[model samples]
Target: MISLNSITRNLDLHAQGNWLPIVVSLVLFLYALFMPKKELSWRDLYITFGIIGYFAWISDSVLGKMLDLVDFGNPKITGIGEFLSYSLIPSSLAVIFLNYLKKTNKWILTILFIIISTLIEWGMRKVGYMKVHGWSFFISIPLYFVVFSFLLPIHRKIIKCRD
Candidate 1:
């Protein structure tokens, strides 16, 4: 008979591989359903899509392939978990953030967003969802800041043009 410890480890590995993405994706879908309504204009959606595309390229092609800074662990969905966590969730949250946040609190929200993202990333590492080789969480902060800074003006321009 297999030892209890071995069975538990195998189950944990399987959960990380197959189940965690489903759980996270479900939570995001639910949050989207219940969040305070804002007009999701085509422009706003385009911005969200940009965020997703940009990060997907950065993480999958640039970071993972080019730089080799990190490896995603045990993703059951043919490596789509990398996109799910890096692109989909963040971009979705960015849409809500852009819609609901007051202009005066933009910087504050940005700071909070970075912190929360970093923590969740760290948690992913702890739970075996993400694996890092030469990457540090600290490196992501500035990169995120840069991406947000670059996107904010474009996002603003889109909303301005639309509304």
Candidate 2:
């Protein structure tokens, strides 16, 4: 049987080490660099980075520190795995998702992202990479909705201002 302690401690997700997420994150970042990008202005970049900041803050500083709700491989960025998996990986996805995704079906797309986020996080949790305390993956569905609420609008605003 898999217990929280076993997963968190033995799996080396938060303590020992994790390689899969770090490698995947690096690959995604490189992919992002080569992906087609529209004419984005400084404002667009700032907004996207802001969204990234919010993502890292909410999960790392707030939930991980203040609320003790989750752990991102490790409490701090002591190695490549922790830095890439916890910080860089999320920000990379945020920048791509926010900058690229269209708001054609606003609510539907939002819900879709929420579902995707939850499922991914659930997988990480199962693998002991992400540990949620006093919270279920279900709660992440709404959390994602909230994050995207700002991300999409800010992205739109930045694009609009540039135009």
Candidate 3:
């Protein structure tokens, strides 16, 4: 019989020291380098980098300290894994919102993003891909929502200005 704990442990073992994010980052960097720069301005790049850095700091320093979500076994190259984990969430959301939903009402998308992202975090916890050593899912969900809310306006402004 496969117990929940056993499943969680296996998932943790599988996820530990994964290199997928690094590879993806390399691909993204290369793609950005080669792509036409007509759409994004220096201000857009600055804002995007700032947002990513802010969220990464929050996730690693603030949230990690509060929730003890740090994966001690996860091998990081110059702390890139930690940064990428947090940055990817907001960056992906920004891309989706800017590319697809700018003209539509944003409230609905905001709610959906919060819900889906929270659920994804919860699922990771359940599967042991994420271990919340000091915090519960209930706490994480609201905290993430708050962060997302704070980031939404910045993302919108940057993307809109660039577009």
- Write out the backbone clash pairs for model 3: none
Candidate 1, residues 1-85, lDDT tens digits: the string is 8998775554444545434554565576466546665655556667665766586666666777677777665432335455466
Which residue pairs in model 2 clash with each other?
A: 14-73
Tens digit of per-residue lDDT, candidate 3, span 51-107? 765766666765566555555334332244444555665454444443334435556
lDDT of 2 by residue, 28-130 (tens): 6775555567544445655665667566756666767888887767654434555566556666666556555565755666676677667667666776766
Q: Going through the candidates in order, what is the number of backbone clashes in each? A: 0, 1, 0
Sort by lDDT, best first: 1, 2, 3
Tell me which of candidates 1 and 3 scores higher on TM-score.
1
What is residue 64's positional error in candidate 2, in angstroms?
0.5
Query: Which runs in model 1 stand beyond 4 Å of their true positions?
Result: 1-18, 39-43, 75-77
User: Which pairs clash in the backbone of model 1?
Assistant: none
lDDT of 1 at 157: 64
